[model samples]
Target: MPGFSKILIANRGEIACRIQRTAQALGYRTVAVFSDADADALHVHMADEAVHIGPAPVQQSYLNIPAIIDAARRTGADAIHPGYGFLSENPGFALACQHAGITFIGPSPEAIELMGSKRLSKIAMIAAGVPCILGYQGAEQDDVTLTREAERIGYPLMIKASAGGGGRGMRLVHTASDLLAQIRTARSEALHGFGSDELILEQALIDPRHVEVQLFGDQHGNLIYLGERDCSIQRRHQKVIEEAPCPVMTVELRQAMGEAALKAGRAVNYVGAGTVEFLLDARGQFYFLEMNTRLQVEHPVTELITGLDLVAWQLAVAEGQPLPLRQEQVQLNGHAMEVRLYAEDPARDFLPQTGRITAWEPATQSGVRIDHGLIEGQSISPFYDPLLGKLIAHGATREEARRKLLRAVQDSVLLGVQSNQRVLANLLDHPQFISGEFSTGFIPRNFADHSCLRPQVPSDAELAIAAALFYQASAQVHPASLAGWRNNASVPLHYRLGLEDQAWSVELNAMPGEVYRIQIASRSLELKIIECDGHWATLVIDGVRTRHAYRLEAGQLCLFTRPGSLRLTDRTQALVSSQVSISSGTLKAPMDGAIVDVLVSEGSVVSKGQLLVVLEAMKMEHPLKSGIDGVLKRLQVRVGDQVKNRQILLEVE
Candidate 1:
């Protein structure tokens, strides 16, 4: 094998950092590339050398094939590693590197091209005699052809972009009426996301488990299957939780699936690390989904079970090394599970949030591994995926792994930028999840009420008691703090505090250390103060017997609790009126993006949830449907126009 002196990582975020660690450990210098937004990113700062590609927009920067090739040439890098995103599956980029005399550390360009298209990949799978979902793969651009195919295939089908993944250009149509509109919208999204609008229809399996096999191929034409990963726990087609050695797959099923994966790999002469995905139905019938021609986001689970560094193997194969070990030698170890920690609010429809990570701390223990991209004070921009890191837990058994993962989750202290940590913890403790009886619809089925996530506001009596305790604690720290005096006469101390939109004006009499007697409108409450540092305070209210933590930041009060917390904004500032309120009879765009489709006319009458407009943002099309059944009073946008968050898209009367 020809050893590489230096390797250039053609991606960013935790994946780049992950590759850098493995590459450097193998005695190779790593070159990292960054856009304007990632200048202070952890991955760029950790690289041996860094190069600026372009602006924050991915198209001009991360997706710029020529710029990446140029960076590799300038850095004297022998090989380029596309770390699972951006141009990772771009066959054109691979061929470009080949022509430039630089090693593309992945499968051959032909393999990538073959599997890149959903239509062609299905064709290949069928030709290989692999079981596949029944769907129409014929060319159908117009709505009429698509509608006919939808009827022929039956209802409850998935319209998927042949050139895209990550749930970007996919739509679920349950009825014939919604098929045409969904197809048009899906095509537009596919074009915007993958630069191609070609799509294929697939039978949407009910209660399907998303299972994938990890395959590795070497220069000697040897393809081996390491193991399998269960990534059925998903939201919007993006994997959230992944586990190794699928809990449902028996030994017999594993051998069958493994052999099928190897056949798929050899059929395309695939090399490097790749995943062959399949959907396993409730009846144990598995159907070939597609093959990702690069390392998967959830590769850590497979690594934990197999005790192998897939990245290292990729480098070895790229350097012309044959498989060092045979498939028979591979041992499946204990169970492992990983959860993706995203910088988005689960309560807010998982919208991408951007802000400074005020506090970023994750647990690192014997069985826990946290692969992260951001650090304290790092900014999360909207131009990229909201993923911050992946938390993986390994154990001797699946039950042990689940318990360890739950414990690590509780120990994590990720603050600022609303995260799905609580949601993950909730899922970990779910009865179905714990018993391994969950499917793709687990989250939806469990969290249908939504009330569990949104905590009710604390009662006024509770807040007054908490405030009195806080005043006493302050007075104990400073003798004259909570008590106002004139001519040695004691008076009530006036203070302002808040709790989740409810404000309070407290009056207290200071006593000794960490004690105070307070009154709130004919009610007397005892106080006990625990600790205070800067704007944060811990105090216990009399009769409540519970210690509560509070923090004052930017004239707002934040209270932290176990199940949830409260965010109180001071009403001193001018209150900005909501842009769209059904009460005001207005409909607004939910995001900042372009108007990809105008589904309603000026004088058209529509019902609630009837598609009125489709706004594309972050490569996903958000259908802005009518909030209420009424006349389309006004259509404020056209087919092609830039819109901002909360911009009124239309009005209904």
Candidate 2:
């Protein structure tokens, strides 16, 4: 029955759900493994069977290979698909699956092992005559060796973790003076994130395009390239947007890049689905980046344009079938675009956000697809990656694809938590992006003045509508009286609304025939309610009519408007402190995470912007700095201590 009658997904969240969709569609029983924190996760409920692996921490659950193998044995699943993250590139996991007489549905363990290390892989690619970035992959990892290598590579080099991906353990050093310090920092991050302190250095290519070729190989010695994807738009070395059929790709260039990718794949004798990534410079010369030996997060873009289900291909290959098509027979179709919907605040250093999702409405229309694991009332935890889903669109041309994707992103909804939706929309609508003239430096270059990406306060008209909604919801207590009615037309009822740390006070008074006057701090605006439904409202503010998807509950209001998702807290009657921070001297945990280092001791004199503590959350390190020049008066956290959001980690005076 195509290698195995049952398949167990050794992952969680959207990827697991995505894999299950293809597996079940092919008539294979699917099993899901979840950590303690994911008992009620969407993937668990979607599977034919579910198994609890371990605690909430990844080390105990998702990365617990033995536990996963045990689950497969108990569930009698004959195959396992390590979807992207957790154990996707882990050679040990693949070896374990092989020893358990299970099909790993990926490359050979030797291939995974070789390609997993940036050091080894670079050496192999160079040996195979592939163009590669000039770098240091030497095994000598001492500070002195790294310092010497950094000098040889010159300034503006990149220090990267040899053992992992996802921008973790990566640092871009613009000067030789900062090389040694950055090496130490990258090493520490590498050790914590990937269980290895080894590193690799490379000449950082400034403003180059990030492009990758998708490759598939079967056990019968057949291999084919599935075109390429442009992933140049990135933030913090992590991809934000991706599109298939690189905008500037010509037939000759595609052939050259495709053949080089094939050469890289053949060096490892790679099998199953894999992607060979490269950094293409403005001059048209490309250098090998790395090879990802699994289905990528943005595979949907390739699939959308090619009209082939990659998971189905993996299954067939694992069953010992040849590649579905040869390289010459491969056909490229229309343009396709994709963007990650991350639970991150773009305006706040792209920090990971956590909370419950109160609403879930993905875009549903022609040529659009959403791969997600969200449900209303689901809580977004800090224990995993912040990606909530992906929005993908395909059309006849690049512009058609871009327009469709922009609408899909704006129409999609993920409430009760911060998302990068606004930034995604802004990026899609960007002139540089529309012209296809951007690179990996797109985000930093455009967002250097980050205020443009900052969350705009709800406009006066939006606030007016919000005030009306709040009045209507609260008036349930005074159902007999018309909402917003006042004894004197000159006076009105007071209200305070807050968005994050920004708050404003306003007043509302009833006028004639469904009209009201909203007096803001500096100006007054007229409002008229056209209609109101369960979760929909139509209103006109200052003669501009608009419709909004809104929700008001227990003094908390959520609305979807042109400004993105706005959740405002009604603070008029609440006796809570309006300050987002207790004081400048207080160093609080930004989110639930484990303390990696306590940089300052009690009584230590600290200056403003001095790094005090390092916290690791969602697989990334965030350094908390002193906000004021003072002596550390209290140090409440130690290394490895698990802390909650907003919990005071230290105090100074």
Candidate 3:
């Protein structure tokens, strides 16, 4: 085996930071490449040396083939590590690395090209005796032909784009009439996404679990499977939760899946780390799905349970090392689970959110690990995926791991960008997730309309007494008169205080024997003030036997609620409110991206949802839709335009 001295990581975030730890531990110096936006990023700071590649856009930086090759040449690194995304599975990039005499730490260019295609990969799987969904894989495709094919195959089949994964260019057909239209739309999307409109068909299972087997191979042709991971908890085909040693997996089923995966691996001569995915039906029958040629994002859970560093294995294998251990030596241990943290608002349909990370602190505990890519004061730009980090926990049992993970998620404190923290916290306490009976439809099937507690507003009675006391004490010039003012006042002062655009009139009447009677809005409120100092007033409200503390900030009363730390701001007008620009004929960019395609002239007739143009940002394509049925009045930019957040691209009239 030829060992490498130095390696260059061609990716970013937690995966880059993760691979560096593994390679450095094995006596390899790591080199990192960064874009202008990532100058202060965590991974860049973590590497031994860093290089400036290009601007913030991925195409100009991470995906730039020439820049990457130049970096490898300049750094004099022996090998390059493509971390998961951004040209990780591109055959051209792999071939370029090989031609430059630099080892690519992944499968060969041929293996990548074969397994990366959906149709060819399926053909190889079926030839190797792997069970597959009943579908068509021929070149002839049209409305009539596809409709007939769908009828023969069955209803509720999947029209999948043969290009890439991550739920894009895929459609579910439940009826014959919708088949043709869906196929055309799916093909267009696939063509736009993967530069290929070619698609295939697959029978969609009604109730199935998404299971995957992790496999590792060496240059000496030794292959080993490292058990299975259950990724049934997903939303829109994106995995939100993952676990190892699937609760429903049996020894016989594991062997069947493992051997099939091995055959698929050998068919392509796959080396380094990869994952073979499958859909397990309720009857214990499994069908082959697509193969991920790169290291998976959810590899932490597998490592937690198996006590293995898969990245280290990949590095060793890339250096022409043989398998150090046999398959019999691989043993599964305790249960482990991982939850993805993202910069998205669950309440707003999980829309992507971008801002500065003011505070990012997750609780540190034994057996619980957090793989984060950014730090405090870092910006969450709209140019990349919304993912923030992954929280993983391990324990002797599933329940123990669940409890620990839930605690860690609750204790996480993130400010600035809106996140799915509350949603994750609620999921942990859910009965279905705790029982491990969840399927791929768990999120949309249940808890879709769940409403979390909103920020509370302070009641009127709580603020009335504070206003009366403030006026009375301020009137007394001497400290002694203000101190004993409550006892000295004959007729109690009555005053009205405003709280959040509302008013509460209070009357404090002193009766015989120094007894104070308080009236607020025709309702008598009984309260005893135990202490009053500066801006704080402590009192108990009627019907609720609780003593609460209130703070007076800038002529407004504020109360803090427990558990959630919900604050009730009692001011007439808020200090600031977000303002959305409301101007007709002004087109705003939906995301922070660069203009990839301009499809309209200065003046063109357009209808609603018409594709005006296409924007490519964060490796995902977003088509700008026409807001109203009107004419394209103006074209402000052309192809390859660099735009900012909320920048106007064109005008419509």
Model 1 residue 408 lDDT?
81
lDDT of 3: 0.78
Instruction: Give the TM-score of each candidate.
Output: 0.86, 0.96, 0.80
lDDT string, candidate 1, 11-90, tens digits: 99999999999999999999999999899898898899989999877989999989999999898998999998899999
User: Candidate 3, residues 1-653: lDDT per residue as tens digits?
Assistant: 56778899999888889999888888898899999888999998888888899988777998898898899899888899998888899999999998998999999999999888888889888998888889876677666777777888998999988876888788888988788888987997798677888888888887689999999998889999999999988887888889988988899999999998998899888898999999998899998988999999999989999899999888888988887779999989999999999887665466676767755667689889998887878988767778888999999999998999988887766655667777777777889889888778888777767763221234555454465344434544455654454555455666555533344556775433423467777777655554456334455455444443434444444332221111223333334444433335567776577798888897798777788888776556667777777788888878988777677888878
Q: Which regions of candidate 3 deviate over 4 angstroms?
A: 141-145, 452-591, 594-617, 621-653
- Stretches of model 1 off by over 4 angstroms after superposition: 452-511, 515-531, 534-552, 557-566, 571-582, 585-617, 623-653
Whole-model lDDT per candidate: 0.80, 0.90, 0.78
The candidate that achieves the highest lDDT relative to the unseen native structure:
2
lDDT of 3 at 306: 88
- In order of TM-score, best first, we have 2, 1, 3
